[model samples]
Target: MGHRSVADLMTPTAITVRRATTFKEVARLLKEFDITAVPVIDEAGHPVGVVSEADLLRPRPTGGAATAEQLMTSPAVTARLEWSVVRAARVMQRHGVKRLPVVDTDGRVAGVLSRSDLIQLFLRPDHAIREEILEDVLTRTLTLAPSAITVDVEDGLVTLSGTVPRPELLPVVKRLCHGVDGVVTVDSRLTCDSADRT
Candidate 1:
């Protein structure tokens, strides 16, 4: 619910390099934009690979790599603009990449997503996290009174301690709380008893 998509967080303008672009030019572009990497695109502006500062610094045999094509890591790790931020972060983690070339449906490079973009999710205020849990998770979804759960949030960490309608709803509460935006972790100390069952 209300998950942020890559399009919402990504930098709309992406810097790119052509396959034939000299390595020196690529380096200059990166420096000019103050970015760490760029997509190596085709004439159609579709990404073919990516070249990062690390790629440029790699050891080469003949006086260093000559062009972006030679230095680039092929099969660029990319994210679609519509993908949820959670999905993009998972892909980046799986591929061991710090940035992703954000693309459109036609596979044209549209933007860029960096590790820093995902970090914004964690920067949500503690009060906001608590309110979301109390309103969205408890009141709306679970149909439980706000007072049924004592939600304490500090730096995005959520602590749930109170009473639930039944033992079965205990896990449900914890799960929904974990899914709340900006929740770093959930400490559920909620109590329930069979006598409370409806």
Candidate 2:
């Protein structure tokens, strides 16, 4: 199967606010859209920052109303739409963020990819995961014949048994198995001909 990209899972119609948007308006947008955060965009439609519910709750200065610019976390962390889902997830984890604004090639905000979107991969059925392994991973990715490997999946755990061409490639196969979305664990039981070290 093709690697899942940020654009594949992101919500393309991300709601955004201008830097000058008032705190009340931000709150309203959050509530109205049922989202935890929204990107603050510049006049050029690029993400300048992100204003989240937590940011809104931070103590405001004196009595003057604050805008998104004053409350937002600037230099927003963003993801490119073409990035693999794994890369996007890594960015979010590294930044300690729950969501990232996905930008286009031109650096314009296109959408948002949230933790929930990444989690959606784990919800795939066990059969689908199994089919992908047998049809895509083994057959296509590893270029192994259909009978060269036996695949079994139960509760997201995968078991691989049969003969592989090379022993050194066992780890590579395992890593590829892990790359399949919704795969929980992989147990490799493949054996190779001892003298076939090429």
Candidate 3:
């Protein structure tokens, strides 16, 4: 089976906001759309940054509002349309983000890829002899564990539960599950807390 591309699973034409947009307006957009974040774009329609729900929660100056440019995260890390799902997951993990902007060859925003999309890809049971396929796929892959992680396979859906050493490992573990056959979806409820301190 061929691996899926980020573009294949991305949300095309996601909601975006301009840098000059006010905090109040940004909040309204997020509330109206029920979204956590939105891309910040320039007049040229190029993504210059991103504003997230967390950014909005930051305490504003007394009697003063903020602009998207002040709250947006710049130098955005992005993924190419043709990049593999594994690569995209790695980037998301490394950046400690739940989503990534997918860009076209011309650096124009093509879509957005989220963990939810990746999970859905693994949640479909369309392959034959799924259990055997899953075993075959997992055996060839390297998995990280403290033996605290639990894996369950039912009707080709993989459910993972446990605590990882770091939040970053959560996405890595999810990506590993995606490599396994017959894994229609992975439901991960892994918590991240410091496991190593020296």
In terms of TM-score, the best-performing candidate is 2
Q: Which is better, 1 or 2, measured by TM-score?
A: 2
* Residue 105, candidate 2: alpha-carbon lDDT: 93
Model 2, span 76-169: residue lDDT tens: 9999989999899999999999999999998999999999999998788899998998888888877888697888988889999988887788
Please provide, for model 3 over 38-94, each residue's C-alpha lDDT reduced to its tens digit, 9 standing for 90 to 100.
888888767888888888887767313789999888867788999988799889899
Q: Which residue pairs show backbone clashes in model 2?
A: none
Give the TM-score comparing model 1 with the true structure, all chains together.
0.83
Q: Each model's TM-score? A: 0.83, 0.86, 0.63
- lDDT score, candidate 1, position 154: 97
Off by over 4 Å in 1: 61-65, 140-143, 166-172, 191-198
lDDT of 1 by residue, 1-198 (tens): 556789988997657889999888988999999999989999999999999999989987643448888998989989998998889999999999999999999999999999998898889999999999999999998898787678999998899988886778988888888777788899999998557445
lDDT of each: 0.88, 0.88, 0.74
Give the clashing residue pairs of candidate 1, or none.
none
How big is the positional error of residue 24 in model 2, measured in Å on the Cα after superposition?
1.2
lDDT of 2 at 48: 96
Error of 3 at 39 (Å): 0.7
